[model samples]
Target: MQTISAPRADARTPVETPAPLLHSIVLDWYRENARDLPWRTPEASPWAVMVSEFMLQQTPVKRVLPAYAAWLERWPTPARLAADAPGEAVRMWGRLGYPRRALRLHAAATAIVERHGGRVPDDHAELLALPGVGEYTAAAVASFAFKQRHAVLDTNVRRVFARAVTGVEYPANATTAAERRVATGLLPAADEVAAEWAVAVMELGALVCTARSPECGGCPLRAQCAWQRAGCPPHQGPARRGQSYEGTDRQVRGKLLAVLRAQHGPVPRGQLDVVWPDDIQRDRALDGLVADGLVEPLADGYFQLPQ
Candidate 1:
């Protein structure tokens, strides 16, 4: 029996080579098959892209679509959002979950206004300096909005790369520099257009090469996929921790925020109590909301969205 060794860190592997086949195949497929997400449209503004990215951090597209449109409609630009109270952003966030993202987005808008002259900065480092922007988001904004050459390595992209390059069903816990190198190696030569290719690859990962129940038959890269050649083995790594929504503080927090969102101003403790039966749990949830800067206490014993 013969055994195959994994590619070494220093080896001049085929995966490291600028495989035109991979880029052309993925980009060509993307041109015809990409989802008509509003943010991906050519007319999307930087502010719109930034908002979409932030809203999409944990929320799915189906949930984010209406909220994204409503958010931009209310606060069209960084200056507009920055001018409004943080409370308004919280209210606008609705039941999107992770309400602190709303506060951070508000802070980011203010920072963009004060530091970047009311425009989303094109520089990756400058964008990363914003409140909620991380490596993936910074690269996403730079590539999607600014049309720069950056490897946008999100979970989907990481999975795609792991399967395509290393024939793995899943990637490691966190992205490493090696992953970046592999992604960069696959990037197209033209910096201006490379961003599109990056987005196309990410779209493919999200829509086709999903974590569970991947539609391998319909995948565009089926012919060239390393995982397909390797017999499409099941992922055997440590299982990812599934999120618990029921009986958790997050659920209570969402319930509290939902009541506040429906109301105009301060909501009484009695009104909030109806959402959760447990008094201690409700109090803890409200306290967590306050700690997270998503809620504030009013003159009476009422709670309001943070100002």
Candidate 2:
């Protein structure tokens, strides 16, 4: 067991070798312990990886698996998705929650077609330029799709690193340059294949090193974890806010969209009214759906999936 000191917040010391060593430990553990997710399969296309990334955001894996398979089957390429109607994309998104991601993914596909000749961009900068592709997403595509050496830091990866490397109970609210520098230090020197390692680590965090009730006993990085070494310190900050689904606008919006998605064209306001009781909240939710471009209003005051 080896220990490394946490760098000062303002310190810019070159990232040390412990990160790569820890990465190797986790990657090797991933090789043996990794789940056989569809996106992780060798045959997964770059487009498939991109779609999976978007679907997995804020959504659970079990919920995403079927949708991911169905989405790829429907649109095997960015060009295929770009050619489809935006409404169709929303319809396919179903009840995955945060339907905005589906629209953003659709927009990203359109951008791919217009800007990158219908190919998912391999370059990090170009991928970042896409509608929904952010730092984590760009790095994910670069590594998973192109096998680039970039560090793909997401919530899972951030927590894993924070615990294993820095002995922190919680990761910062957002990733910083210091985090990126630390992540870059952990990346394998082999520039072409390090992305797999990044995804592997993230998977480990999601499935094993979870925020609540981490299965540290089964975690591969347990032996190297700083937090584990420190007796798994309790999270001391204010408890995270709980999201209310019952009677909330999001629930109302989901119900409204469900009706439109299930039907062919504009559903009557009468039918929409059946989904929720409160007119004010229902109207607000409906207006939000329309604003999000997930629904469109018909001439007759009915609502339809956005065209």
TM-score of each: 0.92, 0.91
Q: Per-residue alpha-carbon lDDT of model 2 for 1-307, expressed as tens digits?
A: 2234444444675223365576677778888887889997889988999999999888989999999999999999999998988999999999898888999999999999998899888899999999888988999988988899998899998998888778887787779887887688777778764777788889888889999889999987776677877778887787667887888888898898888889997788999999988999999999998888888888878888777
List where candidate 2 sits over 4 angstroms from the true fold.
1-17
What is the C-alpha lDDT profile of model 1 across 1-307, one tens digit per residue? Answer: 1112234454665333236766778889899998999998989999999999999998999999999999999999999999999999988888787888999999999999999999999999999999999999999999999999999999889998888777889998889988888888777778866898889888888999998888999998776677776688788867888876899988998988999988888898889999989999999999998888888888778988877
Runs with alpha carbons beyond 4 Å of true place in candidate 1: 1-18
Q: Output the worst ten-in-a-row residue range by lDDT, candidate 1.
A: 1-10
The TM-score obtained by model 1 is 0.92
For candidate 2, the 10 contiguous residues with the lowest summed lDDT are: 1-10
> Candidate 2 at 43: error in angstroms?
1.9
Instruction: Give model 2 RMSD, 1 decimal.
Output: 3.7
| Deviation in Å, model 1, residue 19 alpha carbon | 1.5
